[model samples]
Target: MARLTNSMFPSIPSFTDRFFGGNLMDWNNWNFAGIDSTLPAVNVKESDSDFKIEVAAPGLKKSDFKLNYDKGRLTISSEKSDEKSEKNGKEVTRREFSYQSFQRSFTIPDDIVNADKISAKYKDGILHVTLPKREEAKVKTVKEIKVS
Candidate 1:
C-alpha cells in the first residue's frame, strides 16, 4: 500500500522540529493571522581580535529591537505590532492587525570577551553586534626561523 501525505500541514515529527528544534525562521510557517510565526536568521563570525554577529530582519526599524547582556549571556529580541484599515468617510471597509516577536540568546565566555566594550548597531535591515576580545585571548602571530 502507498502512503498518502499532505503538504499543507507537516507531519508530527516535523511539526516539533519546526516549532521547537529550529532556531531560525522557516518561510513555510510565515502567517499574517498569527497562527504560525517566523524568526530571523543569524550569522556569527570570529576573527583574531573580535567576534561579530549579524541578524537578518527585514521590514523593521531600529526601535523594534532590544538587546540585553547579563552574566555572560547575550540576548537579542524584537517585538512589533502593525494595524491597517481602509475607511470611507467614517465607514470602515477593511481592517487588519498583526504582531511579531522573537528572542535569541548566546552564552559568551567572559574570560575571552571584553563585555564593557561590546557594541551593536542596526543598518540596512541587518543587525551587527561586535564583541571585542580580551588582550590575552587574541591570537598572536609567531615568527618562524629558517633552518640552514
Candidate 2:
C-alpha cells in the first residue's frame, strides 16, 4: 500500500494555529481617553408663556448642580467626588475614589426670552428649568377686518 502523508489532510490547521490560538475580534473593548459617553438625557418644551427644560440625572444632590446664564447663553454643569478609606492600626487596608462631571449649554433668543424671569428647581432626580418669554413674544389674537 502507498504511504499516507500530511498532504492528504489539507483541512487541518497548522501547528502555529493550535499553539497561538485563532484570531478573533474583541467586542467588549472600550476606549476612555476621549469625551465621555455618559451624558444625562434632557427634554425641552416650549409654550406660549415659557420654555421648559428637564434633565434626568439620578443619584445627584441639588447642591451638585450649577447653572449660569450670560449673553443669552445658559450653561448647566455638575461635579461630584467621593473617597473612602479604611485603616487598621495605622495600616491602610482599603481605599476607593470616584469622580464624575458633565456640562451642557443652550442659547436663548434675546428678543423672545426674558432672562430675568428664568427659574430652576431640582426634584426627584430631575432638574427643571423654566425660561419665561417676553410679553411681546406671546402669541397675539387674530384680528378680523370688515371689508366695505
Candidate 3:
C-alpha cells in the first residue's frame, strides 16, 4: 500500500500522481515511456577466421573513439566535446557547448584470439572492430573418404 498524505483516506491518489499520467503505480500507462536511451547499438558476428563488431554511432568523428585490449578484455570507449561561439565585433553573441561519451567492453578468449592483430575502423556511421582468430582455433574443413 502506498503512503498517503491523508491518514483518513488511503484509496485516493495524490494530485500530482493523477495529473502526470494515471496512477503513479502504473508505470506502463505513463505519458512518456521507453524514451530514455543514450548508448549506441552494437552487432557482433563470428566466422571461421575472425569476429566482427559493429557499433552504430552517428555524428562522431573517428578520432573520438578509443579502444583498449588488456588481459582478455576489449574495451571500446568514446568521448567527444565541442564548443561553438559566435561573436560580433568584440561583443559576446551566442555560444553553445555539448559533451557526450559512452563505453562498451567485451570479454575475449585469450587462447583463441590474436590480440596483437586486432584492428578497428570507422566508416559512414558505424565503427567496426575485427578480432582475428588463431590458426588452431579457426574452423577446419572436414575430410571424407568413400567406403565400399
Candidate whose TM-score is highest: 1
Angstrom error at residue 61, model 1: 0.9
- In order, candidate lDDTs are 0.81, 0.79, 0.82
Instruction: Write the number of the candidate with greater lDDT, choosing between 1 and 2.
Output: 1
Ranking of all candidate structures by their lDDT, best first: 3, 1, 2
**lDDT of each residue in 14-79, candidate 1, tens digit only:** 443434544345767554233244567888999999999998888888999999987778899999
Which residue segments of model 1 deviate by more than 4 Å? 1-36, 143-148
Lowest lDDT sum, 10 consecutive residues, model 3, at: 29-38
Q: Across residues 48-148, which tens digit of lDDT does each residue of candidate 2 receive?
A: 89989998877899999999988878899999999999999899899999888889898988788888998999999999999999999998889999999
Clashes of each: 0, 0, 0
Who is ahead in TM-score, 2 or 3? Answer: 3
How many clashing pairs in candidate 2?
Answer: 0
Least accurate stretch of 10 residues (summed lDDT) in model 1?
29-38
* 1-148 per-residue lDDT for model 3 (tens digits): 3432645665665554445434667865543312334477888999999999998888999999999988778899999889999999998799999988889899978888998899999999899999999999999999898898
Badly placed stretches (over 4 Å) of model 2 are 1-36, 145-148
Off by over 4 Å in 3: 1-36
TM-score of each: 0.72, 0.70, 0.72
